[model samples]
Every structure is written in C-alpha cells, then in structure tokens.
Target: MAQTEQRAAPAAPAGHSVTAVAARMRELRASWPPADGVAVFNNVYLTVTEEVGRNIGRRRFPDRRGAATLDAVFAERYLAAVDAVAAGRRPPACWRPLFQYRHHPGVRPLQFALAGINAHIGHDLALAVTDACRLLDCEPAALEGDFHRVGDILERLEERIREELMPGPDLLEIVDPLTHLIGSWSLERAREAAWSAARILWGLRELPGLAEEFRDGMDASAGLVGRYLLTPLR
Candidate 1:
C-alpha cells in the first residue's frame, strides 16, 4: 500500500521535502555544459561498475536514475542544505543512513520512506547490468528492456506481497532473492525484477529476512557455479 498523507506541521525548520530538492536539479541540468554531461555519465558508469564488481556480479546497484534522484533530492532546489544554512533554514542532503527513526523537524517517516522507494528505482539499472553479467559472464554493457517484462515481474512480487505469501527458504525451500533467479538476467529482465523488489520492500513484508538469507547464501557461494540458478553473480 502507498503511504498515508501527512498533516501540515510547523513549517519545517529548513531544508526539507524531496520536492524542494528536485527543483535544484532542474536548475543544474539547465546550465550544465553539453561537454560536462560526459562527466556525469562517466561517474555513473564508474560507480555502477565498481558496485557491480564489489557485489561480485550481484544485482544490487542503485539505478542510474535513482542515483540521479538522490542527487536531485539533495540538490539546492529541493533540500539545499548549504543555502538553507545561509538563509537560516537548515541543510540539504547527506549520507546519514538510508533508514531513520524520526519524522520530526524535517525528515518525515513518510518522506524517508518515499526516498527509500525512490532510491530503489536505481536498482533496476544495476539489476539489469548484474543479470547480463551473470548470464554472459560479462557486462551487458548496453542492453535495455521493454516494459511488459518489467511489469510482469513486478506483478508477481505484488501478488506475493499482497497475499503475504513471499516464499521462504524455511517452509517452501524456495530461495531468497540473492539466489532467486535461476540464471543470469538479461539486463532488461534483471531491471524489471529489481524494480519490483524495490517497490515491494516498502510494503514491509518479510523481504528483509528473505533478502538476508539470499545475501548470506550468495556471500557463501561467490564465484562458484552451483545448483542455484541465481547465485548472486559472484
């Protein structure tokens, strides 16, 4: 289910709201020289590549768009922390923690949750890359996907979430997400699966536990071919 709406509280002390920050990115995008764009692209490629490698071929990347969203969310327009400080408001984005316990002053639990969802958007891109790498044993590098597959993957996860029947290693002997897929994902297919997982997590199902088991199993099975079809890309 989506989040409930929030009441208008005392105007937030300062830098706040994903909306506020998104505004700034627009401004930057407007002025950035054409040539400079390559830098942004390169940075994304480098980071994504590194993360993919670090995860040992696993598909846990923040989507390129999601990463950009983070940049936007914290931009001066949205939550411009520095400007807010100068203007006697507050500050903008930082790498505190993905999850927080408070919703007062600025960071609303709802907003935080929203950010979490948004953050996972990037996972799709990474997911795609990971999938390709796993199957091909090399980067898909430039493959993309169509929407129907993405939609289907999400639909299944949704069914699992709504029914609260996400399979588990304990009862069904079903695998966790890390090893969930049977083989390397085509970049497109992986992205879809990833996107669905991202959205489903917000529903607060038993995803984390399943994720953990997947994580553990993958961690143990890095770089070795095994019975599991999707062995976390290592």
Candidate 2:
C-alpha cells in the first residue's frame, strides 16, 4: 500500500550544478554497502549518468543544455529519495517498496536494478521533466526528442545489464520465477508511462491541488508495481 501523501517538497533544487549532483552520487556510492539494494541501484545509475555526461560533453545530444539539465534534475530526485531513506524518513510512495526490501536475501541484483528502474522511470521521470521545464522555461514537447534519445541509451544499457548480471543460463530455467519477472517488465512501456505522466503533470501545474493529487496517484500506482517487481524469489 502507498504511504500517506507527502508534503509538497520542491522536486528539484534550484541551480543544482551537475558537478554537485555527481559529487553527491559518488558520496552515496562510497558510503553505502555494495549489497544494499539502494547502493546497487545507485551504482548502475551512476554509470549511466557518467555515460550521459560524457555524451553531453562530446556534443552527442542535439540539445546539450536540455539533456544535461534534464539528466541532472532527474538524478537529483533519485538522490533525494535515497537521502530520505537514509535519514529514516518516508520517501515518495514510488520508492518505499525498494527501501523496504533492499536487503532481502532472496532478492537478486537484477531485481534490484529493475525495481529501481521501475520506480525512477514510473515516478521520478515525469516530475523531472516538469522540473526541467521550470528550469528551462520550455514545454514538455520541446524535450520529447531528448527524452527518447535518453530512453534509447537506457535500453542499450538495460540489455548490457542483463547480459552481465543475469545468472548463468543453466540456472535460469523456464520454470524459474526470475524468468517470469524478467519477462514482465519492458523499458519501452516504462518510457511511455513517463511521457504520459509528464504531460499530465504539466497540464495540471496551474492547479496545485489537482496536480498534487495526480502526482500522488502516479506515485502510489508506481509503488504498487515496484512492490510486485521486488517480490522475493530464491
């Protein structure tokens, strides 16, 4: 079940320099135990962020500033969620499941990565887009292309993660619950949901009450799915 609605906190901090964001991630990585679920997800995210930064530096993204800002803003939300958990506060509904089950012995690394992806993409991405719009003074449509481009990078990374982290073929039998879990999620679907939520949140921006309601609904729904994804399977 989703937790009670959180007081509206600013989704992204103002003028959060990318350098500061990177430093925060590194600090978290260094501080957390490697086996902790949040740390596992953080490691994967840090790699992706590093790659995105390198790509931005190389003029890879057509709208470098937009991509960079979006990435930074998006990352800050995740880090904030991490900090909330570490501080013994309730995080957003979308994140509570992951923290609840982070250290469960039956949950594998792949599950940890995917659960984090689910919570981040399903809940955080939409807010991040809105946060980016506020910072960039642009519409969500303007950021659509950049979003897809980043999604493509994420898809490739997901494939690589599966190849590198999945248990050996011999152990992953058709009867394995892991196989079913893996089959149940799609990066494509998560991206589509994020896009839809972004538009909805943007449309409701003027109606703070309605926007907060919608955001909470999205958060609860994502949390529910995340809980399913994190189901212990040994």
Candidate 3:
C-alpha cells in the first residue's frame, strides 16, 4: 500500500483515550449499509469488544486493570486505522486492502470480516500491546496474561464466525478459495507474532526510529496477506 496524504496524526496517538472506540465502531456499523465491508467487520468486532467489556466488568480476568487497559488500547488501534483511511492518509498495510475493496460487491461478508481480523491481529495487536504498556507504565511481560485472555476470546469469536458464516455443507467443497484462505491463515500464528513483536517493540522503545521501521514493515507484510485474502474470486 503506497502512502498518499499524510495523516494529521498517526493512528490515534500512543495514549489516545480508548473510552469511546467501541461506541464509535458501533456508530460506524449503524452508519454503513449491511453489505459494506467495513460495516461487516465493524459489527463482528463490536460484538467481540462488547463481550470483552462485559467480561471486564465482571472481573473475569485475573488482572482486571491489565485486561481493561489492553482491551481499550487494542480497540483504539483499530479505530485509528479507520480514521487514517478516512483521512486518505494511507491506512496501515494490513488495512489498506480492506478499505480499498470495502464496497466491492463480489467480496463476501466473511471475507471482509476475516481480512479485518487479519489486519487487526497481525498488525495492530503488537502496537496495541506497546500502547498498553506505555499507558500502564509496565512491561509487555506484565501484560502477557491479559494478552492470552484476549487471544482466547478472539479464537472463540473466529470459531463462531466460521460456524455462522461458512457456506452450507453441500457447497463446502475442499477446493473453494474461501476454504483455502481460511486454512492458510492461522490466528494462532498471528497471536504468536504479536507477542514477539510486542517484546521487540518494548526492547526498542528507546529507539523510536527503529521501532517505527519495524512497525511499518509489519504493516506492509500483513497488508500483503490481506490483499491476498481479499482477492476477487468471482
């Protein structure tokens, strides 16, 4: 994804408040048509975030504050990605493909949801982890437990997506492109990369230039996968 106009700010400053990110996402869903790719992904993400919020309220995680902070910061990154796109500032590499193909009628809702998830998890997640650390004044190691809990929720949500969105059994041929796409991309793999990236970012926190370079590379690589995921099969 080539950079176009520069954003007024990079995807929500490092510590931008996340208090309204979920609500903003909900608003986006309401504002767009149901078939809109961004709206489709927004709806799914909103549900996951809402669930996380509810669980946080219930004190489900061992580290309640960490969980809340992680969830909030995590959401902020996605919202920022959208903001970047809206400003025509060239959203992160992972997200550019989704925004570009958002209104393409040939893309399925499931594809939209998956591409968004891929971008968010593969790219935003590591950065979000760093954001949480900055806000909480803690180390990434301290947030590992919270990260795992959130990852668990994401995994379950992915399973639900498959159950609800996959085509009927009769149409589920092994050669289907969607099937191949799903099988090729692993959320677990993304989660692992996020952890490693978080640690790397933390280690390079003092070297802002180097850290930004790593982030850009990650974004571009993830975006490439997203583009592949969004390939128009029809």
Which one wins on lDDT? 2
Model 1 over residues 109-215: C-alpha lDDT tens digits?
A: 22222222222332323332333333333323222332232333433443333234222344344453332342232334434554454334423235668765543
Query: Which structure among the candidates has the greatest TM-score?
Result: 2
Please write out the lDDT profile of model 2 over residues 1-234, one tens digit for every residue. 122122211223467555567778899899889999888888888888877766666667788788888988999899889889778999999999899999999998888889899999999999999999998899999999889988888888988987776878954778888889888999899999999999999999999999999999999998998999899988
Candidate 3 clashes between residue pairs 3 or more apart in a chain or in different chains? 93-223
Candidate 1 runs further than 4 Å off: 1-44, 47-67, 71-185, 205-211, 214-234
lDDT of 3 by residue, 1-234 (tens): 122222111223344433466778878987899988888888999988877766665556777677777887888788888888888797777898999999997777888889999999989999889988887789999989879988999899989987787766743788788788778888999999999999999999999999999999999999999998888866
Which window of 10 residues has the lowest lDDT sum in candidate 1? 1-10
Q: Give the CA lDDT, 0 to 100, for residue 13 in model 1.
A: 22
lDDT against the true structure, each candidate = 0.31, 0.85, 0.82
Error of 3 at 194 (Å): 0.5
TM-scores for the candidates = 0.21, 0.91, 0.89
